[model samples]
Target: MQPSHPGMTPYPGQPFYGWYPPGGYGLDPSDALVTPPGAGLGGWFARCVGAARRGWRPLLPILVLTQALPAAVLSVLVLAVDPSARWDAQLASDSAALPANFWSDLATLLVVVLGGSLLLGVVQAVGWAAGTWVIARQAVGESAGLGAALRYGARRALGLWGWTLLITLIVTFGFCLCFLPGVYAAFALALAGPVYLFERHDPLSRSHRMLRDRLGLLLGRVALVGAAVIGFSLAASVLESLAILPFGTTPLDSPGTAVGAVLTIAVVAVLTLPAYLAQLVGLVVTYAEQRAHEGPVNAAQLAAELG
Candidate 1:
């Protein structure tokens, strides 16, 4: 027999991961988002694939606008303001001294990269929130539209962006200290976005709690997601780098070069869409599973909470 109460966790090792329904897997067979802790990797995978299939209509446009386009603009900006031309000059001059404007160029490069990161963070905030809304809706077989999802994103973007910036700072500080610490910080804070959206308070601490409670499982799931997204990103970067080699250090010098640069970036930007989809679906669904491990929840409850 199951625990007398749905919330009771009999095993000390299991913590908040209580009993599922009689089906021996999830809370309900009819729902994709209710996969409890005992449902295993298969359950989580099914839910992720289901969320993607159900939510793609809204997800595609949301990702393209917030994720892809901003990325394209940032790429263009970085290439346009590249400081590498000075390096070429320095090499050609065969001088032991640095370029006269080397420091200035380096400053400009840092500004563009940092500034572009901040702007891209804004769009990514919107995309993450909107994508969550769609995933929650479609997980329960309910319709989620692009307009409504985007509107919801607009409402939550500021708060999410703020949290993201804080996480970024923490990660940066950890990196300053050491590489391992930075990676640990990233894994720990990975769930903050979904936690903020679904619970709205102390997301950083709560996400850390989830990671602490189920370290191995959460690490495996999150690492898999990271691998997929990072792999796709590396591939895109390589393609974009190769595509721009013909244009030289300063691609914006001529109209033809500028057009080639933009087009190559545009292609690479489109290629980023899969990374976006995998990231959104994988993390959100994984977060749901973490919630299931914590306490009683279902697709309907999550959908209601998302609002």
Candidate 2:
């Protein structure tokens, strides 16, 4: 049985509405009189699963392209410039005075690669913010066009980009200030996105707020999703490892070894699609929970759109 509304007149056989967070708080966790945290968690998990099922296909290609292009281009440039062991070996043998031109060219190439990577990082951070905003709009039931969503996100891109750079610097400085705390600080800062996404709060402020909130629930959901990701990643690693097992004595030290490597990569790419989808699902669910429990966001739109 379902209740028509919260705490008004109960439907026949319907439980009371005390299970919900409160009046004006979003969705009810369940029909129970006293809903436990586990019930809230379960609802969130289900919401994540449902949202992922709907949005994955439309969103994934964009996500991949956004992340991949700059990374691939930057990596290629880096590899092109970086001196390989073979080159170093050849140079070592011919230590009969290397040409000044070689040294200058190598130095120039290294600088170009490094500069390209830095530039790519700035651009990619913007792209990631845009991607997240697209996911956010979809969660909110806006029939937002990718172009429009990206444009909206672009308005905040500099803020997102600057925040990321600032965090990177903080993590680096923290590491220098104290190696152990720095490592912990890096992981602790991961909650900044949920803050930005759910509370519409700034990343730095979210970090502090989440610290106060004990991050247990958020991290719990993230861990569940991360487990799924790791499982897929491990499967891929296993396949790659097995490829080596087939040629027991033969070392994977040549172009021939690429046959198995390529196959493994292909399989991994195909399978990891679901894991990536799950990540988006987890992200949306986190936001949905906020909309439900916190009255700031219009949960009515989510129920209609995501329903």
Candidate 3:
């Protein structure tokens, strides 16, 4: 066996000479202990799962508060403001005597709903940025606390948000053109977050370039991770509904029922956090795998470079 590179650290019980160059070994030992020696779809999934297991402690809270909390809060607010029953009551009663501010009330509700949606987007952006930092640290066998992750994410929040908006617009435009083009565009730009956070490069163009010839592998890995997230999310939604069933039959009608519904949603948010973490881990692994294919580099090396 050849000697390991000067800066490389061999895993315990693994000889220094056993260390292979970036793409040569398939997966980096420092990044993934269980993944096989190649950066294939299965290897990527294994690495992601391994990373999630190892870094769940720090990853969970950040994901819950940043990604899930805002969403759950907004959902509860929307449910509370639902105007269907109220509108129906007004219609049945004297239509001419409808409340003076009925239209104004509706306008106010619309503004609040839109504002809540915007806030949720901002929170998710921060979460994604910070989560990326945490994953980068974990990939190199390092640990970062929630505070450090949040701080790092705050610094990058604006950039990440802008990137997200740009990508959304582009994808939306592609969809406007045709469904197939939109799907193609979405898959092609999937690496924008990782590329933006880690490489500090133009994520849109860089992600497209990195995925130029590896579309099939990227899509397969994404589909696997996406399916898992969807499954977990559906399960969480079902559980949330069941949990809130005891609150009351008319959850939207009373203060007590509303409070119970909100709490249930919050709990559900925390429960489904793992799904978000899994998706993040998969993306990080996918980014590292793509980098390996592009050149002779491993996760540790990428992490070091980002640092």
Q: Highest TM-score among the candidates is held by which one?
A: 1
TM-scores for all predictions? 0.89, 0.63, 0.80
Off by over 4 Å in 3: 1-30, 33-39, 91-106, 176-178, 238-253
Q: Per-residue lDDT of 84-141 in model 2, one digit per residue for the tens?
A: 5445566777868564457776886778776786676566555555555555555445
RMSD of each: 5.0, 8.2, 5.1
Name the 10 consecutive residues with the lowest summed lDDT in model 1.
Answer: 7-16
lDDT of each: 0.84, 0.52, 0.73
Writing each residue's lDDT as its tens digit, candidate 3 over 63-178 gives: 88888888888878877766655766777786777655688778877977988877777788888888877776776578788998888888888888888878888999999999
Decreasing lDDT order of the candidates: 1, 3, 2
lDDT tens readout by residue for model 1, 1-307: 2332232332222122233556333355445776666668898889888888888888999999999999899888887778788687886787787877888888998999998999889889999999999998887668888998999998999899999999999999999999999999999999999999987888899889889999999998899899999999999989999999999888888999999989999989999899999999998988888876665566777777777
Best of the two (1, 3) by TM-score: 1
Model 3's alpha-carbon lDDT is: 0.73
Model 3 Cα shift for residue 148 (angstroms)? 1.1
TM-score of 3: 0.80
- Candidate 1 vs candidate 3: the lDDT winner is 1
Cα displacement (angstroms), candidate 2, residue 265, comes to 8.9
